[model samples]
Target chain A: MKIGYLGPEASFTHHAVKGAFSDEEHVPYTTIPDCLEGLITAQIDRAVVPLENALEGSVPITVDYLYHDADVHITAELVSPIQQHLMVHPENESRWEDVGRILSHSHAIAQCHKYLYYRFRGRALETSTSTAAAAKYVSEHPEENSAAIGNSLAAHTYGLKIVEHNIHDYHFNHTRFVVLSRNPILDELRLESEAEKTTLMVTLPSDDRPGNLHQVLSAFSWRQLNLSKIESRPLKTGLGNYFFIIDVEQSFEGVLIKGAIDELEALGCTVKVLGSYKKYSIVQK
Target chain B: MKIGYLGPEASFTHHAVKGAFSDEEHVPYTTIPDCLEGLITAQIDRAVVPLENALEGSVPITVDYLYHDADVHITAELVSPIQQHLMVHPENESRWEDVGRILSHSHAIAQCHKYLYYRFRGRALETSTSTAAAAKYVSEHPEENSAAIGNSLAAHTYGLKIVEHNIHDYHFNHTRFVVLSRNPILDELRLESEAEKTTLMVTLPSDDRPGNLHQVLSAFSWRQLNLSKIESRPLKTGLGNYFFIIDVEQSFEGVLIKGAIDELEALGCTVKVLGSYKKYSIVQK
Candidate 1:
């Protein structure tokens, strides 16, 4: 099997693909859209993309692409603990005060905002396409006055030295990754004990009448079906227009899920099922 | 009266403040947290900040700051149509092919992703703190090879010329700004004809029992109260924990609003009224 992930290798998505599908041949795509497109074109059998972060909330591009741009289905979910480290070129030994610039992906920079601001007060901050790419740039340039924030895997991959370990501001930072495929997972591949989650894209009635969304929620609420998450995204039509992406803690095989959809459609909501899959978590020590 | 807004001047927030409070003396704060801090310190009588955008969804910093950091109340709402333009230094005559780099805020860059990828493919894209800041940088540098994506006001403020108008990927781009004050607006100062919107910060029952959120929504649904918006934000305590920010389409004066709160509290939810205020829209032609 082949897997595609957002990369320049050693990125969090790369780690996710490695952790989830050991021994699989993996290729790195430059962007999230590229990974999805690769899956659609059969350049790869599956794609692992970050869906959300514990601290940053949702990844809008991933959500937006799944909702509007792609015909892919999420087959499985994986969670990985994010550990950001400050790295330098292997041959360069510069004191902390000698550092003139810092580089990382925007989110990594944001996650380490306080540490960076206090330690490297006047240093120039730059964003790269990925954390691994930042590490690669630092490694290739061999600048004594520059450092990169990335993972240990990136340090290993790019032949860089880890100057500081776990520099991320928050300790509980974790990113959720979803495995996407052109076709849904077959029943034979399903794990019986794995927890199921069904994602739905729902558009409420256009009128701002009282109880429109409430009516939609009532369909699941009254059925005792648990909703794990609910997010509102703009329909891109205009202001004040939105559609809700809901994740229910149940599979699509049951009557309850079907009944909820039936009730919602009756109440004038257009519903589309994005996926029904088993949730998985990979804990990195 | 004095007002505070996020600025480096000619920013959307600056425009929002200018449009909404034409007679008030407006001061610029460097960041959203600074604006909120100004309110807490009584440094300004009111502050206007972006709350949400039509294309991008919620402004997380503004929402998170309001919910967690400060005790300020939202007194009014303003909507502004966002128009992004490709701008260059007037003296630097540059054709589209001559542009080697583009600069803007991350959101602005993301908004113009399609246009930039197609027209200025492989160009170096950099992010600044604000779109206006990007324009200022481009103006001061006066490089023929560099341009900026910003608003028309930014072009005027920075003495730059618009190379292309409406360069944003989507047409219906709008930003929603909120007027925040330390003290609630007095009844005498309230406009009777203005439409009301009450924003609420709600924490559903901590236990993940089925129907907890549904029950909370049912409180308003049964009262036939209209909920204009519902957004779920991470509580930051841990993953999978969230609190909802709901905006109702009515003021807090009546029995229905009060009844909804009472019902929610009875159902083991903590509710905080963030504001009850008039809605304002500034249309740019």
Candidate 2:
């Protein structure tokens, strides 16, 4: 199966896709939308995109995209442990203190916030592509006035120095990535027994009234269906409302959940099922 | 008061800091950590750091740094609307069709996820510092195969063309930024009349340990304290615990909140009072 992910190869999304598919060759996309397009046009069999970073929270694009398409299905999930590093040009070793700036993706910079504060004190920090791009920049410049914080592979590829290692403030930092595909893989993967997830995107009516959200959330609680995550995204249709994405531990085909779906659809609102697949566990990482 | 915010000028964070302190001049910071350092050393009277994007979720560093000094206090908060643009070097506009790559901050790249997919089917997408940085990069390396998706100001500054504009999936994309300082600002500001916010940072003993989270949340629910936010940050001291950054509708100094604080502290967990400032409604641009 061909898989799509954001990449220049060493990106965390790439690692996540790699982690999810042990032996499958993955196609690289420059953006998440491209990955989505690949799924829509049948260019790829599956695509993996980040849904939420433990530190960064839920990615709205993933939510919005799911809201945009009713057919896109989430087949599996993966979580990548975010480990940021400081990579600098090897030629600028002794002059490291001369480094006046640091470059990385915004999230990378944000992930290692405390370390940059304590270590760099007052230095210019710019955002760039994957840590690999940051390392590439430092390698091309080879100036002590700049450095980049990224992954270990970035340092090796660009011949950069590992000035600092795993510098993220939180030791348990991790990001969750979701796999999307055009055709629903739930039925095919169900035989594996490990497949145990169902994600749904539901849009409620535009009236700002009481007990609306309670009614929606109760649909799951009443069925004893464990809700994993719930996030809202604007419909952007100027409808003055939002769509909610809910992840349940059990498949939607289950009788109790199917009954809950009926109750939700009967609320005089729009509810669309996104996908059902096996829960990608961290223990598998 | 001298305030620090991520920017060169006209950056989203720059606009946010201006919104936070309309009458004050804010010094531009190249990175979020530099802004945090400025707050730690009193290099600036206060610093504005984007904590969470309504559409994108939390900015990890802002949460991690709350536990840095235990002395740094969040004196105020504000939210700014974000509208991403697709800009390119002016001289390279005729090559739009030939462009094989696009660049911007990862979040910017994510926000314009669908737009990129619909527009460029098989192009390489890259990341940079804000959209402006992407514009700057395209300006420096004017290749027919590259374009940048960012802010309009960046395109103007770098003599880039607006290949596309307002491509973010969500129309109401707003980010919440917090004003932080070394010593808490006890002096009432002109906005005191509108001040109705209470921010607190509490270190929980552990994660998902039944009563730990329930107890802390109950403090607010029991006292009828309207909690606006509850963010989790991994406590870095190897205690295998986490901290909860909670924002309520009432001032921390209020008598009602005082009782809540006592009840929260009695649970054998550490709670640091962050700030109690006037909350202002965010006006979307």
Candidate 3:
């Protein structure tokens, strides 16, 4: 089996792919769209992408692409704890004050905002395509007098030294990654012990009426189906127009899920089931 | 009266501040937190900040700050059309092929991703604190062979030449701004012709039960109180814990809105009314 992920190498997505599929052949794509496109073109069998961060909420590009650009189905989900480290070139000797710049992806920089503001008050901060790319750059150009915030895997991959470990502001930072494939996974391939989840993309009728969304939710509420998440995204047609993406904590095999969709359609909502899959949680050691 | 907005001048927030307050004494704050702090300290009578963008969804920092960090109330809302331009130093004679780098705020760069990828395929892209700051940097360092993605206001303020106008990927780009103040505006001070909106911050009972959110929404559904927007934000306590921010289509003074809140509180949810204000929409010239 082959897997595609967002990378330069040793990025969080790279870690996720390794954690979920231990011995698979993995290819790295530079951008989220590229990874999805590779999957569509059969360049890779599956693609793992970050869906949301516990601290940062959601990854907009991933969500927007899945909703608007691609015709992929989510086959499975995984959660990985994010541990960012401050790394430097192994041969360089520099104190915090001697460093002139720091580099990482924008989200990683934001996650460590408090520490960055206090320790490196006046240093220039730059963003790279990925944290591992930052590590690779620092490793290649040792004279830059810079450090990168990335994972221990990146430090090992790029031959850098870890100056500090778990430097994020919050201790409970974790990112959720979803595996997307061209076809839905078979029931026999799913792990029986894992919890089942179904995701739906819904749009209300064009009429500007009261309780339009209320009626949609009532379909699930009346059936006692639990909703795990609900988010609104702009339809991109104009301002004040939006569609809701909902996640229900149930499998699609039962009558309840199908009936709820049928009921919603009757209430003038456009509903599409994105996927029904099992969720896997991985704890990093 | 005095107003504070995110600025080094010629920013989108600056335009919002000017549009809302024509002749008021205006001050510029370096960050969103600083602008909110100015209002809390009575340094300014009111502050205007970006809440959400049509393309980008929501500004997390602004939403998080308003929810967790600051003790402020929103008094009015405004929407402004966003127009991005490709600007260069007037005296520099460089074609698109000669440009080695592009600069803008991260959101602006992301908004023009297609254009950037096609025109300057391998050029280095850098992020500044604000789009206007990128324009200023380009104007001051003409020898760097860099252009900026910003607005006409930024071009005028920094004396840069606009090489291309309206370069955003989408034509319907808009940003929503909210006015914050320490004290709520009196009902008599509001414009009667404007539409009324009441924003609420709600937290469901800590128990993990099916339909907890469903019951909360049912409170409004039964009362036929229309909701314009609903969003979930991490409470920062831990993963999977969230607080919902809801916008209703009517003022709090109405019986239906009040009854809905009473019903939600009865169901063991903590609800707070963030504001009841008039909505404003401004079109750029």
Which residue pairs show backbone clashes in model 2? Answer: A30-B125, A104-A128, B104-B128, B195-B278
TM-score of each: 0.81, 0.75, 0.82
Candidates sorted by TM-score, best first: 3, 1, 2
lDDT of 2 by residue, A135-231 (tens): 7888899745588887775676678888777888777666767777776775233222344778777777567443455566667765677655555
User: What C-alpha lDDT does candidate 1 achieve relative to the native structure?
Assistant: 0.77
Per-residue lDDT of model 3, residues A1-285, tens digit only: 899987657878887777778778999865566678789889999998877652222266677678777889988888777788899987665564477799886557766766876878667877665687789989998887789989888898999988888887667656778899999773223222367889999999999677788778888988999887787777778866788888898988889999999988888889988889888766564
Ranked candidates (DockQ, high to low): 1, 3, 2
* Model 2, residue B185: C-alpha shift (Å): 5.2
The TM-score obtained by model 1 is 0.81
List DockQ for all candidates: 0.35, 0.24, 0.33
Query: What proportion of the real contacts between chains A and B does each prediction keep?
Result: 0.45, 0.24, 0.37
- How much lDDT does each candidate structure score? 0.77, 0.67, 0.78
Higher-TM-score candidate of 1 and 3: 3
Angstrom error of the Cα, residue A229, model 3: value is 0.6
lDDT, residue A201, candidate 2: 77
DockQ-wise, the better of 2 and 3 is 3
Best by TM-score: 3
Over the true interface residues, superposed, what is the Cα RMSD of model 1? Answer: 3.9
Deviation (Å) of A218 in candidate 2: 5.7
Better TM-score candidate (2, 3): 3
